[model samples]
Target: MNKKVILSTVLFLSACGGSDSGDGISLNKVKSNDKAKCSNSRLDSCYYDINQLALNIMFRKNDTGVLNVTASVSGPKQDIYFTGSDVLEIHADGEVFLPTNNGADSLRYENIPDNAQIYEFFWYRNSQLVEYNSIDGITEPSVILSTSQHDGSNTITTDWLNNPDYTYQIHTPSLWCTNLNYESEMFSPSTGILDNQRPPYQATLQALYGKNIESLKVNYRSCDISVTLIAKNNQVNYRNKQKRLFIHHDNFSEHPLTLFESN
Candidate 1:
């Protein structure tokens, strides 16, 4: 299916078959990141901050087990919506002010459910749907993450375990990082293009359905082995000068169990 269709399917699947709470969730203190550099008035900064805000709420829900979350985010983009069962609205002008290259834009979420398994964010540019982020596999209370620019181009599936230092093995076009006391690890290269010659960290990854995937299935370590679908991208290798896919093995050692998926 196409990327748009895949995104729509992801949203539909996330919204279906989940326990709902009667108490709604809310978000407060929404502020855009003014400290960011934006050629187009801080697209990356604005987008990143808002996205981070949503993720922060998700993690908070996991930790506290609160049924509703009320938080706010500020960034460059305006007319943004955080969609799940209900919508978290964004307002362009708010009470707070920040020192940004662009003007301050604020948003807030009222009564967000702690049991919300999926989150989809829609961002607009010139009244057009420029980008959207779909977060799924959040049923478990462990850390949650969707794909980001930092992941380069690989589709990824991540797991966080209570016990650490476990050796993991998966098929190629796949890599596992272990041998440390990290509670979280991510595995990839599951049903996508594989470029063996390139280093794992430098490779550009893609999703199975489309390039620049906005939807992902998140899971905890239910089994010893799991598979993830890598998305598409055009990152090249400097040494070989060829387009390739690589493996990523990140063991978040030296840090306690905190979610690093937002960066």
Candidate 2:
């Protein structure tokens, strides 16, 4: 195997709905030659570059009552739980670039701005940005909306440790799921407004709310960014030398599911 320094300058980004050259990242970067497992096995390509990455962006409130925003990234390279790296960063909305600290096997950031309209994740080495492979997706909020568990047991049996498993909503402009309200219970969330604008906020508005959302002047502390654009954030490597720079991008957030299902 004659490996040479190629200084590959191509960048790759794919998310939610998978992509081919026609709709998403360029197909030239996706030469499926390596048979090794990718960080995201769901993707169909191997022998790729931008080795193992799993990023989970969550918007929740910490104990101090401030919104806690975190992007947890791991390098599941080869079979190990981490990848070799030095730095990580985020591109918030337009040209704003935010740097984050990296641990041995993971990348993380917090204190994200409430007004940040959209965000893109990236990995860096030696101060320059590098592409990532197989983003393991965000943890989209799940609510037990409308269930039969309350047929007389889970809801009425009061001597409980957690909140009653009942049908309620935590509403964003588009998402009616969890509440920003916190009852004086142990790690339980009340049903009310969404605390932050998450990636799914806008889609919730269009799917269930009216078509005149922009005209309605609805305000949220968080911004609902499209998952499709979550992968829309890609960057080029600046280094002039490299041993192996294969190419691939994986954003697995587009798994199909019913927003609401009735029992």
* Model 1: residues with Cα > 4 Å off, grouped in runs: 1-59, 67-108, 139-263
On the 0 to 100 scale, the lDDT of residue 234 in model 1 is: 24
lDDT of model number 2: 0.31
Worst 10 residues of 1 by lDDT: 236-245
lDDT of 1 at 144: 24
Top candidate, metric lDDT: 2
Candidate 1 lDDT = 0.28
CA error at residue 164 for candidate 2, angstroms? 22
lDDT of 2 by residue, 1-263 (tens): 21122324434554444334332542223322234333434231222244444444444433243434444443434332222333344443343333343332222345444345444444444333343332222222232223222221111110111122221122322222222332121211223343322322223233444322332223322122111111211232222222222222212122122232222
Highest TM-score against the true fold, candidate: 2
